[model samples]
Target: MTGQLDVIREANLGIIALNRPEAINALNLEMIDGITRALEQWADDEEIRLVLFEGRGPRGFCSGGDVRAVRQAVLDGNAEEADTFFAAEYRMNGIIARYPKPLVALTHGIVMGGGIGIAGHCAFRFTTSEARFAMPEAAIGFTCDVGVNFILSKAPVHRALTFAMTGVPVGAADALALGLTDCAIDPARRDAVRAGIAAAAGAARIDAALGALMQAEMAPVGEAALCAAADRHAGLDWTDEAAIIGTAGLEPQLAQLALRSPTSLIAIAESHHAARRLSHIGAVLAADLRLARLLCRLPDFAEGVRAVLVDKDQKPAWRPNSLAGVDRSSIRAVVGAA
Candidate 1:
């Protein structure tokens, strides 16, 4: 094990497990750098034909980047440290997306924020029944980064916007339907599946091996009730910006969005649309970098993180407290919208 990450070279498989179970394997900068280095080294390694990512602890595969530390950096007058962290994290996402070897992520439990960054780009994305997925950056007064918007954009526009704005978590079935995960295996079958993958990696039969697993017809447990409720609750007119604004209290999802930073909501919507048109993961990540640089410096980001993570208080005093109060033009500029 290396620091918070487990870097293992077994047979033809390179496995990296996030080892911070106590904190739900929340990623820190060291972990990001370590993952990047491993992936880079393995990219050219002839022996490592495939890579597998796992997360330690029962709570989830990965909760996300240590944004609490980012908040701390800003409070300590080291905002540049926060910037550096995001830059490196995004870089790692790119590396994983472009990896020459087939990459599989065995995501269980909570996969949020930075967790999605790593898992979402893999060639083979697997989840257990207990896995929950979300890109909850808006709730923390931040916009999506690490190319999450790219993943979200791949889903239906309404679903993407709702998740981005509300921070609602979806289960494995919803994830599969949304194209977030490829297969849902029984939690009890975790080891057998890992062994199967290892064998496939050794034999250079990755596709055939995984296809068998996919054909198991195992029923995906858990459903996205909240996501469904949100869809049923409202038919948002996204074309007209005004229709999406100032209606935060109209439904359950909107109520959650009401509690988030208004600026974050605007940015999420803008970025989601921008990502839809981007030609590739690299382009989406580049957009995310620009948006992250801007969002991290905003007052709402600090306050939102403080209220939600640091203080454990749900009350975040957003700078532009209402959606209508936010400047769409400025947010569009940051997200590269027309």
Candidate 2:
């Protein structure tokens, strides 16, 4: 109703809540602008020492951007309007990445695409066992944006490629292992943890407060064992660090992704590969923006979105229909060294 955001001041902490829970708090342009403007204003306010970002929902923190709507904007002949959304989103994401004070993201349930870009940069990120994390854009003929490569760079490259190609969601344990989240908490104790953080003194005490509450529920055991069992079932060799997904017993996921746009998958994988050599977030985001802006005007993205979200057919007639037909140079051009 308000194109709203919930702001509360407690102690020296300023809390920002993503108020749209029904849509899994999926960010729209208005929400992005609202939150970004708020953070910029908060950055200058002396009384606010720390920020706790949250989503109001029983299911997950945020699913991602309302990009299906953005695609619709483009279809309605307003490509620049669509571009404005990404620009604002990327700006907001960058602000979060460089937030001056202690910043904590309370994440649970589904966090993917733009959700990862926002929370991934926070200094203190907490997720529960219920969290499901992924990039997941390639499935809709787009690559992950907002410098996802920066996070993926800190993760295992092969696993990142597999994630890009297959859109497979990972759990908190795996996200922790992949450098996607800082801590895992108990789902039922989320409110208590928020109360603890709110009562915490400035930046220094935030750690102690979160750590105290971080133990309200111990991390579940067997994350590694769970991954191992899945790997074994997939007939993947866990020991070979050099093994790629195509060789790592992920044949089923790969085949499933074959139903999507192959060009998008390759672009994502290539971006991850290129990002490995870059160390700075600014550089990574610049590259991501370049690639994302380019992908926006392309045909497959709209087609893929129509098939996956609008039509619910789960069948997209992707150009370069087969992986073999996907042009290597064109994919490279999308995320290429300029």
Pick the lDDT winner. Answer: 1
In candidate 2, which residue pairs clash? none
Pairs that collide in candidate 1 are none
TM of each candidate vs. truth: 0.94, 0.88
Mark the regions of model 2 whose C-alpha exceeds 4 Å error after superposition. 1-3, 201-204, 211-217, 224-255
Superposed Cα deviation of residue 149, candidate 2 (Å): 1.4
Model 1 vs truth, CA RMSD: 2.1
Tens digits of lDDT, candidate 1, 1-338: 68689999998899999999998999999999999999999999999999999999889999999999998898788989988999999999999888888999988899998998999999888888778898888888898788877777777777777777778788887787667788888888888777877877877477777777666735556666655755764578643345554555456555666566778888888888988988888888888888888888889888988888889788888888776688888778867787
Q: Each model's C-alpha lDDT?
A: 0.83, 0.74
Q: Root-mean-square deviation of each candidate, in angstroms?
A: 2.1, 3.7
In candidate 2, what are the lDDT values of residues 1-338, reduced to their tens digit? Answer: 24456877776988888878888888998889888877898899989888888878778788888888988988888888877888888888889998887788888888888888888998878887778888878778888677878887776565555565667787887787778887787788777777777776454666777676666555673373323334444543322223433443455544445454666766776777778877778777777777777777777788888887799787777876655666657656756643
